[model samples]
Target chain A: MEKYKRNERIGAIIKVLGDNPSKVITYNYFSELFSAAKSSISEDILVVKKTIETLKMGRIETIAGAAGGVRYIPIMDDMERKDFINSLCNKLRDKNRIISGGYIYYTDIIYSPELVDKIGKIIAGKYIFKEIDYVVTMETKGIPIALMTARYLNRPLIIVRRDSKVTDGAIVSINYMSGTSSKISTMSLSKRSISNGSKVIIVDDFMKGGGTALGIIDLLKEFDTKVEGITVLIASKTPEDKLVKDYDPLMVLQHLDAQKEIVDIVPYEHKDYV
Target chain B: MEKYKRNERIGAIIKVLGDNPSKVITYNYFSELFSAAKSSISEDILVVKKTIETLKMGRIETIAGAAGGVRYIPIMDDMERKDFINSLCNKLRDKNRIISGGYIYYTDIIYSPELVDKIGKIIAGKYIFKEIDYVVTMETKGIPIALMTARYLNRPLIIVRRDSKVTDGAIVSINYMSGTSSKISTMSLSKRSISNGSKVIIVDDFMKGGGTALGIIDLLKEFDTKVEGITVLIASKTPEDKLVKDYDPLMVLQHLDAQKEIVDIVPYEHKDYV
Candidate 1:
């Protein structure tokens, strides 16, 4: 095997760590990959750590144990995340985004890969040590952001469906009253999708009534799953009291007047959890 | 101002490149980021390039001119991709994955963030130079893989809804015959989802008769868009002739006997285009 230089090993190590965020990578694996001694690999890791910290890219947590190595913990600087959320809010405030149903047409922003990826990373950064078992979401518009969140968390994604399909095998379904529409809606999850006692974070695109997220929480209960946190891209400002008491939204949709073609969106002033 | 050493610069460069695959990063950007000269950044990129190529990680392309910079292009070695597909097929061959309706339970595998991310990268690798404007998928199961593919391609994602929702604003609905059920199904896309005369690739989790893919193609035509190609995770073997021709699947489901609890799956033998 060709031995890699110090720079080569550092570059490869960063790439691998970034690819598998929140997942520990064994030093033995890196040592083998570079055809170098563990001591040299250790030295390379120090350089990689400095690079990440100096750039404020993210934090690298080193684990000390038989199964320990280092894991990349994605973090958005407080000021940087605020700026990002503010910019995204600005984009959502476009007057043309107003639709007839008092809804903002944000399908373009949430479906955007680059922007969604950043949002996911930001959300994932909030719960780096939450020990989340899975990232869950209701079907349709939420999958993109949910999947991105799961990617950053290095966890599996579980999608709750609107209706159970034969392909889902046996499933758990529940009904909840929508806060916005006041209509009863059913959400389903495959019985085998999540394990009992597993902790998960629920992510979604839009949260009007918080009914969908509550429905998902109820559905997860059937499997004895625990929701670690609830996150959404946008939340309606009206009806301050949501079905779920504790949930975070990236932006607060203060008002959307389709008649006047106006959409007011502001970044959520989240608790200083970070 | 602090300056990044050679290894630190290489590590940071790879991280930036990995984060923005298929997207260019100007030398000036790196120069500013590292507080280093453009010449030093160029040398660091050369080392980064060597590390990636030597490890068969992927290919990096350098563009010249005033807009000159480096771009990371993800590609799976042909053999590595085949091995990954075969291993995924083995996992899918589980006897308990059989449901009563002749449909194999693959929700777990496809919903798996790590596995789905790899599948997306492999699919995106095949069309790196296709200049795809967007990565499209129908609602529900395909969103994870499709989102991952779009992330790697650095493009937007467009999801066709099974039914029009109030939040969709104005939509273009198309009715197409289901390939397996032979029943009429409706799919809708927001009119402003895709630009006119742009090219997109349709990605889905499963393709039984390719009816859904065909429906998406028809829906995109309403926007005067071109369907560059179609890719799926699995395709049924019985209906070898699908509604859409020239599509590719990562795996082929040879047979599924629910009674015997048997599912025979094989990795697709793709053309040696790589």
Candidate 2:
């Protein structure tokens, strides 16, 4: 076996830790992979930790004990976070995004891997200390953002379907009034999708009256799971009566006159949370 | 601004490249971020690239020209890929995973972020050299895997809906026979979801006769898009008469007897392509 250099080991450690965010990686694992001693690997980890901290890229947390290891926690510094939100709001302000029926075509941003990964890091950073077992979301548009969040948080993603199918086996279904259209609709989840008594973080792309988020909350009741938090990319201003009140919205849709193609968007200010 | 050290700059560069896999980052961007000269940043990148390659973690390709930069390409060596598949097959071998109607309850694996991330890396690694515009998948179970693949490939995800909704606006809908049960089903995609003349890689969680994959192919034709490739997590062996001819499946399901709770699973051997 070839000897490993310090720079090579540090680079590999950062890559492994970054890939598995918020998940502990034991020293033994690294030592074995690098064909090095535990003490040497520890020095390499310390170098990674100090470098990451110095650059404000992220943090490498050390967990002590028999089942302990180092974990990576992704972070977007205050300046970068503000810049990202500002740029996102600027992009959303484009008149070309306005479609019929007061809708904004922001699907491009939602699907963009670069943008969604940053969004996920910022959102997941808010709940880094929470005991979240899973990240849940409604189907279709929210899948990308929610999946990214689940990746950052190191948890599984549970998607609630708009309509149930037999391929899902037995499912628990519920009817809830749509907050945007004021029409009743059904949302379903596979009985085996989520375990009982799990703690979940509900995420969505857009929240208009919070109908879908509310439906997710109601659906989780069937499985005896608890929602630890709710987050959304954008929340409309028209629907003041949001079905779900507690949520960390990144941006707010203040006004959009589809007929005139006028729009007003602003970043959400969460006084209570990061 | 504080003076930046070589180790800190290299670590930051690695993190930035790793976070934006398959996407290029110019030296100018790094220089500006670190307040360092372009030549110094170039040297730093060379060191980082060499270190990563030495460790077999990934690649940092430096594109030369007026319109170029450094890009990261993630790789899972043969040993790691084989171990992932073997362990996955072992997990799938559990008799309790055999649900009613001969369906294997593999949702747990599908929802697992860590497992799905590795699966995405392996799948995306194959197409690292292809000109793929989008990563497409059907609604529901395949979303997580597909989303992770899209993230790794640095491409946007286009989800074909099983049922069209009002929120999607105008849509292109198609009906295809379900491969497993021989039942006709409707699959729709928003007209705005995909652009014309784009190349797409279709992915799915499971395939019983390649019906859903075929449906996606047929549906993408409506938008004048080309099918660059087709990949799936599992393809059942019973349905020998699959709708699609060319595909890159990760695993093959040889047998699934519900009453006997027997399953024969094996990793796919693709001699023609990566």
Candidate 3:
């Protein structure tokens, strides 16, 4: 709070919400306490709401009727979450994504949050249903989706390091071939992470050949926990099938031939939420 | 909109906000339009507010009088625009962080949006005063900060790829000696990225030695563009002064001796925004 104004109306609003079991509060009372214009109070609430909710500190509820006001609820549940992962699937399935040879190009989807949120939500919803203990994802592209899902679920996200560090202490490593390279790569997590029998949801941005999916699956097994569910933002349509099965995909890439500049993207069957 | 009923409501809220000159709206009208309960409608509003506003669609406003409601304003001045980057710099300077040897652990900060928002805002603010045409950052840890800053500023974030792929066509590479290792390694990005004279900001998660920062600086200079700003989440207090003088660190590490078991952290002085 050094750079931010401590006595600002927004800070006061957040302070008024200090550790309350109830997430809801009346705007009028908050407005009165701040002694600011209702419009200014409203703006402060808007900023605070965005900051807290995005930071995963419960959610802000704005009631409009006679009893209407604002509420800050510090609750985390498995239901009513879906957006990022689903959109990610839709963008990944875009036929316009031309993959030359065996590799698929996710340039459009990675750069689009609409897609990322869609896929993040779908994967998050599925895991939230299973009482997930933690969210585990690899580095780079997967980090964004993992961060999004963890935020939605209100859980701590732990990254599986590609290279073990001395700071991480003794680590447990898992190696599997990548979907695209067919070359063996490794991922590791701290030995003290997630207790035995804990449920874990594996999420990634995209899974073309399922090599990364299988690698995560391997890591989960090594931890002696439940895989619970595996979610990928996008999967490629392979005539020869993929490396792994029994997982969910947000979207499917039909054709990706970058050479001909043709990419066919199709929507997934996750329209139930609509 | 295929993932949740709330998404439909959120989408409707955005659609209602289409091209509206006013930045504020009444909760009653929005709720009535959806034919949803005022409370439920408020919940929907919060979701849409965070998603859209975070993505830089506009700001949310509230009126306090009996006739007041929420409003969406699409105005962000240079200072206000960089809130994302500026926040990024602030949160990364947490003194609570513990570092062993030269490496600092910011995994917890990266996973938190509140922290990310702060870090994102600070970095964005630095370039807000500059003539930045683009935002650039290295892969892995830096992508999230860069992306958040880019989103808030409504600029595209170009990532430097550590590993080259077939789809990248031609690539330009730069070498840097990592903090963990004194050996030099090459990092590459697509050749057609930043145009000549384009102003850029270089961002990263941690700056143990500034090798990667220097590497990206070299790469941007290769494009004949100027590096408008260099911002990092954490800078190591390695006793040896940094080689790159044209950089700003949100936090500087004072102690990082594994054998000594001590660490200190502090924030950098920044412009006061009231």
Compared with the true structure, what per-residue lDDT tens digits does model 1 show for residues B9-72?
8999999999998899999999998889988988888899999988988988999899899999
Candidate 3 residue lDDT tens string, A1-274: 1222212445445534532223356777756654556676677667666655543444566778888777654433223333433444454445444444545556435544333433454455555435777788887667667765664555656677777766554579977887767688888876655566777788876677777777877887877878776777666677337777866666666776666656655545653331
lDDT of each: 0.88, 0.86, 0.61
Residue runs of model 3 more than 4 Å from their true location after superposition: A1-102, A112-130, A179-182, A192-197, A258-261, A271-274, B1-104, B128-131, B167-169, B179-181, B192-197, B272-274
User: On residues A96-211, what C-alpha lDDT tens digit does candidate 2 reach at each position?
Assistant: 88877778888779878789888988889888888999999998788888888888899988888888866677889999998877789999998988889999999899998888
Top of the candidates by TM-score:
1
Q: Which scores better on lDDT, 1 or 3?
A: 1
Best by lDDT: 1
Question: Which window of 10 residues has the lowest lDDT sum in candidate 1 chain A?
Answer: A265-274
**What local lDDT score does residue A163 receive in model 2, on the 0 to 100 scale?**
88
Per-residue error at B138 for model 2, in Å?
1.2
Listed in order, each prediction's TM-score against the native is: 0.98, 0.95, 0.67
